[model samples]
Target: MIDCISFFGLGKLGLPLAALFARSELRTLAIDIDRELVARLRAGQVPYPEPGLDDLLAEAEPRITYASEARGAFGTDASIILVPTPSDAGHPEFSSRHIEQACRDLCAALKARTEWRYHLIVISSTVFPGTVATRIAPLLEQLLGRRAGRDFGIAYVPDFVALGDVVRGFQEPQFLLIGSDDEESHAQAAALFRRIVAPGTPIQHLSIRDAELAKVAANVFLCTKISFGNFLAQLADRLGGADLDSIASALALDPRIGGGFLRAGSPYGGTCLPRDVDAFVALARSVDLDAPLASAVRDVNKAQYDLIERHLLAGNPRCVAVLGLSFKPGTSVTIGSPAFELVRRLAQRSVRVAVYDPAADARESAHAAFGDAITCHESITACVAAADAVLVCNSDPAFRGLAAKVAPDRRIIDPWGCVLGTHPGLVRIGRDQALAASLLASRRRKPSLRAVR
Candidate 1:
């Protein structure tokens, strides 16, 4: 039983994961290179917003310790690295410098330990295939002067959790993937997961390279599904009377295509999906192969964004209020967010923009990124009231009643089709006809609202 664990990198995913370990009764040493972050975690203050993380950290406060150096990890039985693997500028591959630096620091700490016990090192960071066996493992051996599997263990145990729903996602993972070169290393990593995951969770063991590929492949497959759904929507729009929602619903009935990412909406924008697709393409290219389907999927996603932009810019509303800023609901992350990109475009066109999200961190991110170019609002009502048009970006349930808030003449551009009602101004991206023409025609009628569940 691994009772003590150390986690490197205390960013969005890392802090929650470390807190989860501590909540599971493990004495966890969480380290980060940022002194301010370390200080905040030390004082039991979460540096960012993650649903349920504050309470989880509160529960784990007694069992968890925060540190700015690797020395604290020496006492832990296993060290897990969850550092960022940022995509390299002007390349499809990730820059592994951050992961490499973490490994180097950990190696120095391990070498200086006066007393040594066999320690397990697991990496949960996203990486390109062959990175572990070719780069990380060799670097560890060269720096520490110790052979893996004999003196210590190395395993790739990436977590498949998304932001906002990370707590539930972690506690109820569909399956666990463990990649290691040796049986002992695999066993150690598997034991840790078994302890945390619920009973009957499927666990697969694979070689280092396969696991790396599997992670990227899984994300790319999801992106494919999303793009396919968008493709259906586009086809439905081109062919009149073809309902995308109904078509998707029937397609989802097939066991092979059980409705996961089948809902048609804004382009699949986020920190993971786009990056993983690019990585897959980059990997295929590196091996003298072409992944046309993957490339097409990316192109389709970009097209969806263009479609939404066209709808939002219809009639050239003097001021537009974007209801959601985060890529998805329940997260403050604005990276690769369609709404954020829309704001940028609107700013460039000198279209006054107002933005609001449920999370303050997301609002702050927008304020910081756009400065005075955009206006951030504290409430949905205020944001909608300030603009002449409203663009519903994400499918946040809170935006369902937005039609009631908008004035009859003003338009509501909902790409996700999440907003319900027969308001004349409501423009459903995949469901409605050419937005500008329809909006022009609808203004010649009376608007009324009545609802029943």
Candidate 2:
């Protein structure tokens, strides 16, 4: 019965969802306020670089339409709002202005309709708990002058897709969660997702408040796992004869602690994990509850970043190369990227830094972010060619086996253990012996102060 779908804010997540809906044989309309983005999308060009997005857009071109205004899509039976819910500046809460404006515009369009019928509105944006029920639902009703669950229905359904693998994630989700104010809204949303997802996909229905909390809670839990792994990695460094990779592998065997997000690497960064963890801590404090565990997770992550920076600085290499810029592999977005932060820190210390990423536009992104302070290279070999030290900040598959190619004399710092076995000049952060030896060798190679005198 749900044949038409309208998507608001067609950014990274929304675009793929819209394409998938169109691919599922539903007539889909993708709307955004950015005219340039809408123009590009209409020309069969993707505004952002996401793996498989171009192919999906092409496949759904026949059934998909791009628009710049919500008024153009009022004919659709359902609208899914995916606008940005940025974290408030100097606060733990999300800014509701974007979503609020989006709802107001949507209501204005719905008001223009000649006839009123049951319409479903699904919010796919991540918001603080009680946002849908307390804030959004009331705003929509006030604007449209219609009672919700009677004239219109609302559902909260946040997607759990990561940046690089969003398309594949939609096709094969571990579970589907729908939070609705009423059974009719829940059923309609569930029915639509069922058509798009694989048959028999597990779907859990809850109240709007629970769904909002669950979305952030899931991300916060993942952050905790990552921070715990980093803590273990630090322990391995302090305790002799311990390797984080080996220890993490052992921990993964236990069913309670899953294998995912357990890799000992750079501090977790990107759009979701870091901010959501902070938001969760804020939510706890808002209710007058102490979240020391969550707070500790953040503190541990900062320590991990500081540890890596300190290790990089200990080596007095005048020139250093960073091999990855984006937060993770398979996407070009550098928002909240550890590599970007590391590059900035190195530049601040007057260390000449060159960076590269196989998937990201390093030249444009790096230059825009750090302007003339850092050099951006197009390839891994070119980036490391002139540098005496190299840091593999991301676990991009392109960085695998990179150690075999680097000169034996140059120092290689790999926190993610992307490189294979030990090398004389290689220093793995979580493994102390290699790092100590690397430092010792560097110190011995330096000219003595007494000899200079």
Candidate 3:
């Protein structure tokens, strides 16, 4: 059996994956170019606050070793390189410099370690369509001096873990999607996944390009559902006082329209959706496919964010308290987060913003957004204690409990619809951009807008 070695750069994607495999008692060599990160991991902890991950590393210290230098790290072992391949800010997938650099590093590693005839390199990073076929496969072929299927193996397995729920996803994933060029590579990739993920989680094997396409398309479809929800919410509002909660229930009876991921939001951001959709658009452009519908999914999300920004501006609240920052409900990774975007846009006004999240602080994903301008509160009650209005950015369960206790005089804007069963002073956006504005327009009145399970 070949020994295990891994290369990583993006601490968010790379750390957990490298740590997990190392924890399994495999002689895993984790490599990064950064000297500080190398030193930090060597000291038995990662910089990010992924749940249960610090503890996992403490347990796996003997198995996992961190390295700044790749001399001994690139031994004759199975190398799995996980890099952060992010798309550009454009609507369509537009950047690959990170992936290109990662490939170049891997190519150098391949050349240096030619002694290992049976090398298995897996791409766990997210990439645009045709990445493995156009970029990864050819690089491997050129470096190894052999055909892929006949001599070596490779797989494109996108990591589906979010920041806060990463450990949960890693320990108990929905399923594994491994894209391979040939049978040997597919089998090898499946075996690696079987070792890591839970038994019976099921691994789907397809062409490398197919797997890459599936990930981007899945994001597009999910974004489309979000936009469709927003569209329906608008129509529901114009129908002379209608409840979308009920209308959605009525529509969900149809088999085609499932009642999942169809909720409204400020907008989809933080690490995916926008960029993935952009990548898909770029891919479609390359392939000469007219993806108007897919393209609009991103446009709709952008408009949704703009609507939220306008609503906040319309209120003209002096002190706005933001509840969450991460893209999703669970994670603390706030890069390109809609809430962060909201905060930035809102800062252009004269509003002073105080932020709090149950799982977020200066450590995880809040520092960059609220360095010195915002106050980080210890609890949700403290976060909203002195605010004129509260904007619920993420759907943390803690916010729901705290929302009930919010003073009757203050207004609460729940963009994520965390308030399932409603209370006084709480407003559910529920995908209606207009309704979200209406909540900000009216003052605190009688407790009439209440939703129940």
Q: For all the candidates, what are their Cα RMSDs to the real structure?
A: 5.6, 5.9, 5.4
TM-scores of all models? 0.93, 0.94, 0.85
lDDT by candidate, in order shown: 0.85, 0.86, 0.70
Q: For residues 173-238, what per-residue lDDT tens digits would candidate 2 score against the true structure?
A: 999999997989999999988877888789999999999999999999998999988887777665
- Candidate 1 wrong stretches, greater than 4 Å: 433-453
**What does the lDDT read for residue 107 in candidate 3?**
59
Model 2 — TM-score against the truth?
A: 0.94
Which stretch of 10 consecutive residues in model 3 shows the poorest summed lDDT? 444-453
TM-score for candidate 1, please give it.
Answer: 0.93
* Ranking, lDDT, top scorer first: 2, 1, 3
Model 3 agreement with the true structure over 1-453: per-residue lDDT tens digits: 545765556377677777777777677777787899888777755687777888877876787778765565456456676766755555355345665666566657666764657667788777778777777788778866777777778888887776777766876877799998788788777776677688799788878888888877887888788887765544443432235666667777887998766666567776777777777777777878978997787777777776666556556688888887666666666777777878877777758888886664432456564576677786888888888788888777777675566777777876556665555656565444355456544423424543311
- Residue pairs with backbone atoms closer than 3 Å in model 1 (clashes): none
The candidate, 1 or 3, that scores higher on TM-score is: 1
Candidate 2 residue spans exceeding 4 A from truth: 360-362, 432-453
RMSD of 3: 5.4
